[model samples]
Structures are given as structure tokens and as C-alpha cells.
Target: MPIRYALPNDADAMAEITCAAFAEFEDFDVTREQSAANWRRNLLAEAAERPRPHHTRIAELPDGTVIGLVKGGPADPGLGLDAEILALAIHPDHQRHGHGRALLRTVAADLCADGFGSLAIRVLAVNERARRFYTSLGGVLAGEVPPGEVFYAWPELAALL
Candidate 1:
């Protein structure tokens, strides 16, 4: 998997993939319409800044088609986390491969090198698949966030690196 910083042109495809990935989560008020709208807002907001609001990476195949994306950056003020992975979505057609893991490894490596000791990821409480995937990558259930969301933390970043 080739992972690289996302470019401006990738927003549409990224939004599509993101919406598709999240639309299956039944525990939210999110609708397909809301997801697309949110993606647009997020991409625009990030692009308007000098540096991106989040550190986002795109995973592409050999021929340059994006198959997955991962976004991480400084944790939210109240999270008490050193760093956070905001999103990780692999296209349905590309899921079950190692792309998601590869993206996570890339983010973890960078955050660790930057001296972050812990990394947090939030998953829907009912999203067992996502919870399992994070656990497989060494994420431990730390606590609950907002309604229907739980926080998973890599307390020992070294264990992941």
C-alpha cells in the first residue's frame, strides 16, 4: 500500500469512501446526506488552513487509485490524550486487506516519533467490528466519550511502534 498526504483533488473520492464506510453504523443519527455534507465542510476547513487541521493520509494502489484514508492529529482539548486518530476508512471493495493497518502503523509511527506517549481512537459503542480492529492493533478500551461512543487508547505507544 502506498500512503501519502491527501491532495485537494482527492476530496470527492475521499468523501464518497468515508460516507460509504460510516453509513453502515446503525447507532448514530448520521444519514448519508449528513456524512457527505460533513465531509465537504471538513475538507474545506482543512484546506483553508496553512497546515491541515488533521494529519490525513490516503492509501492508494499501485495504479494510484485511493482505497483508504486515515486522519490523525492533536487530541481534542478535553480528551487528555496526546494524539488522536480522527478517522480511518477503507473502501468496501478494499476492506479486509492490510490497508487500514498500514495506515494506522504510519500514523502511530509518526506520533510516536513526535514524542506522543498515547494515541486515542473513538468507535461507536455498537461498532464491534471497529472495536475489534482497534483492539487487534493494541487499542484498549479506556473510557466512554459522548453518547454511543467509546474511547480506545494505546496507553503504551511503544507497544504499538
Candidate 2:
């Protein structure tokens, strides 16, 4: 898989991957329309931000089929994290093939190069598979929010590289 910075043109494929990936989770509530709209809005916002507070990357095959995406940015100081992975999704058909890992690593490297020392990501508490994946990658349980969300953190972002 080749990972590259996401462009505005990649929004549609990113949204489709996001919708298909989330659709597999019964606890995730999102409509296709909402997902599409949200991706567009997010991409636009990212584009408009000066100095780009966040980075979005896409993972695709050599033939140009997009399969995964990851968006990350500086985290709120209150979260005790220097940066946070805002979103990560791989098309269901592409799961378990390392696309997700590659996407995450690519973004993590970008953040690390930008001087962020630690990273965190929040996932639905009901998502055991995701929790396991994060833990396997050296993310430790960091915190939780009410109504079913948990945070995973890598205190040393360089460890991921």
C-alpha cells in the first residue's frame, strides 16, 4: 500500500471508505449521507486552516484505488496528549491487510517529525477489535469519557517509528 497526503479530490473515496468501515459496527450510528457530508466538511476545514493544524493521509493501491485514511492533529492540552489521531478507517474489504497499520504509521511519523512527543486516539468502548489493535501497537489505556468512548495513548510517539 502507498500512503500519501490526502487532497481535496480524495474526499469522496475517503468518505466511502469511512462509511463502509463504520457500517460494520452495529454500535456506530451514522448515515451514508452524513458521512459523506462530514468528510467534505472536514476536508474543507483542513484546507482552510492556516499552517494546517492537522494532517490527513490516504492509503491506496498502485492502481489508485483508495482503501484507507487517517486524520491527526494537535490535541487539546487538557487531554494530556501532544497530538491525537482524529480518525482512521479502512474499507472493510481492505482490513487485516496492513493498510490500516501503514496509514497509522505514516501519520504518526508525520506528527513525530512535527515535534509532537505523544499521541492519543479515542475509540468506542464497545469496539473490542479496535481496542485490541491499539493495544497491540503499544497504546496504553489512557482515559475514558462518559457514554462509551475510551482513549488510548502512546506516551512516546517516536516508539511508533
Worst 10 residues of 2 by lDDT: 1-10
Q: Estimate TM-scores for all models.
A: 0.81, 0.90
lDDT to native, each model: 0.77, 0.84
- Find the candidate with the highest TM-score and give its number: 2
lDDT top scorer: 2
CA error at residue 5 for candidate 1, angstroms: 7.5
The residue-by-residue lDDT of candidate 1 on 11-122, one tens digit each, is 6667767777877776545555666677678777777866444666778766777778887778876777789999889988888887788788877776677677778898
lDDT of 1 at 146: 88
lDDT of model 1, residue 11 = 65
Q: List model 2 lDDT by residue over 42-144, tens digit each.
A: 8889889987878888877777788888999998676799999999998888888877787788899989888899999999998888999999899999999
